[model samples]
Target: MTGLGDSRHVVVVGASLAGTRTAQNLRALGHTGPITLIGAEAELPYDRPPLSKDLLVSDWSDETVEGFRLATSAELDDLNLDLRLGVAATALDPDTRQVTLADGASVDYDVLVIATGAAARPSPWRPASGLLQLRTLSDARAIAARLALREPVVVVGGGFIGTEIAAAAIKLGCPVTVVDPVAEPMTRIVGPEVAGSLVDLHRANGAATRFGVGVVDIRGEAGALTVVLDDGSELTASTAIVGIGSVPGTAWLEGSGLTLDNGVVTDARLRAIGVDDIYAIGDVARWPHPGLGAHRAEHWTNSSDQARFVAAAIAQDAVLEYSSTDYVWSDQYDWKVHTVGWRDPQGSSVLVGDLAADGRVAVVHADADGNACGAVTINWVRALNQARRLLMAGDTAEAIAEQLEQLTVRAA
Candidate 1:
């Protein structure tokens, strides 16, 4: 074992949010170890959520683009990092603790953090042309170019990404239609108490929706395409953007001997199962969560939180097990959607405020014993803040709803 000290070298795969934050946190925690950050994309690490929320709609300037960067060139140099961008880790040899890069080069490390993250699921309905997916800055730029054409667009998913893009297209004066296989695609996500309201939000904002049908096939080229649905219906569009989901970037680790399930399975301490000195974090790492059992979170907060946790454990020799409530936020059209903790379908849900009447809503979920477990708030930051505070303190659904109602009245 190469001991855990400032003298050891730490290699991080994937220079996105999780990986970059891991290195930053290590440095902040006073670990002067030699750190090598490997990234597949040539671009410096940047924020991703804005790609769907703002980049597609705004007339961004050079300074605005620079703002997206996690750190500037000078800032990175100050960290004294061996930043290896435009190259990806090809293979890993755990026995030797060496990572081989794509350019026929290998780097050794005493500590390794598998923050490689997940990639967008490839579109299955391949047309002659004009298909898009958002996973990288380059991908966002390509989609922005297509969206600039001001032609009709079909977003083939009803999730957060798809809806955000749809909202952006609508703002761009493009005819937009969102298609999803599930009747209420958000039911499984935001829950039944408020899913329909969110779907109606898009309709109210001038975007057509074709729910309860799956895309069977797509044909034609860019600016003129046909989308065939499973329900024997067809829709024509100039472009189609698939925001289905993402898969862990574990293909390169095929024979690496890591217990790969949906992601790199990690124990309670966020350490890769059955391995010493190697840890996994972010979307690519499935850690044993205290609240939800073995779980993998794809939210931005989850990745950032896990990075800090893992870095503390490594740099400061922290012994606490990793724990966090699931949190996700999205900017869809004119409303801000914020969800904290998990949404339990089996648990009781209390709804406060009406979306149609007031354009704001909050849903608090309570466990079997009437303890607040999770919450979703839309266009109501105060209520969201209170819910998060009360949830952490284990408040009851009734009490949460009453306080939210009081807040609603005061705001009114």
Candidate 2:
């Protein structure tokens, strides 16, 4: 791997976690090149995980929010990034290697890294004032204020964000109801076996569930909202938080000539397809995975991992193939759920421990070929670690479960 030289100017669009990390990694990897990090928001990059968990349930304060900052002022200065804040990239001209900003300014670069990430999908059923979606810091602040009211809350979509928001609402003593269009909304990600336990956990915590139903309409104003379900039932709540999912923030790249599926299509090396010296990372990159095929990972760890890999690739350091272990965790009530690799709901899953008795369970999933593809564990960190190691080694699902069981027994 050869370096891009000290004089090469690299422009990073999107001053997100991925964007900030990329700049830091480039400097750390001995790249003396000029680097510019641009973001649409005026504030510095902050950690988003707490937005769904701690930020929502806790008392609202600017100081409390500042605690989630990814880097302090001194750390940002050490990174030495040419920070462009409060402006967004309006367009991209890959041919000219220039990015057009909203302020009628264009930044030319020898290398470009797109880390625009993703935005929360807006709910089709929009009410006057109570409808909300959590993506940015402002959104979290608004939701936190609403939760502090201790009013009835309806959260649409039972995905990770939706569930976590429900958990937060529960903590605030709010009457919360989570609605999803599937019998088990997170089954595709955590498998039906483990997902069932999650559903039960939420139910036990006093969060009502309305699965297999969709939101047809939202009526009324801020303090009084009626959420009409597909089954002709109406749920009355003071506020509604829609956490359906996220879509790639690739609208600005409409005519950028780069291939865009769900995101900017990239090779295994994180380089944009058919584009020279252009890369995409984080939620905005749909990269090829060796085992999972083409996939876009929206997890926080994925963004950081991709940023580190792309930085090394750009700096011409050790060129290693990018392969993600695909890790994600969720904190719901007292349970800490963790998953590794990919879980297919339709795939065969073998349970290793009792989920009902101890809330410590591991579900090892296997593909059609009987190869361990993924695993989900609840309050069982050791089992999850063991499954990850075995899965990476291409162990069979049976073998992984057997080993996990033995480890559990030995510990007992």
Cα displacement (angstroms), candidate 2, residue 85, comes to 1.3
Query: Which candidate ranks first by TM-score, i.e. highest?
Result: 2
What TM-score goes with each of the models?
A: 0.97, 0.97
Against the reference, the lDDT scores of all candidates come to 0.89, 0.89
Q: List residue ranges in candidate 2 displaced over 4 A.
A: none
TM-score of structure candidate 1: 0.97
Clashing pairs in 1: none
Per-residue lDDT over 1-412 for candidate 2, one digit per residue giving the tens place of the 0 to 100 score: 2575666888999988999999989988878878999999998899889999988876667788778888877998987888998999999998889999999999999899999999998788878889999999889989988988999999999999999999999998899999999988888778888788888889999999999898899888878999999999999999999998999999999998999999999987888998868999999999998657888899998999998998888887556778996999989888898999886545688999898876699999987667788999999999999899999898999999999999878978
* Candidate 1 deviant stretches above 4 angstroms: 1-5, 368-370
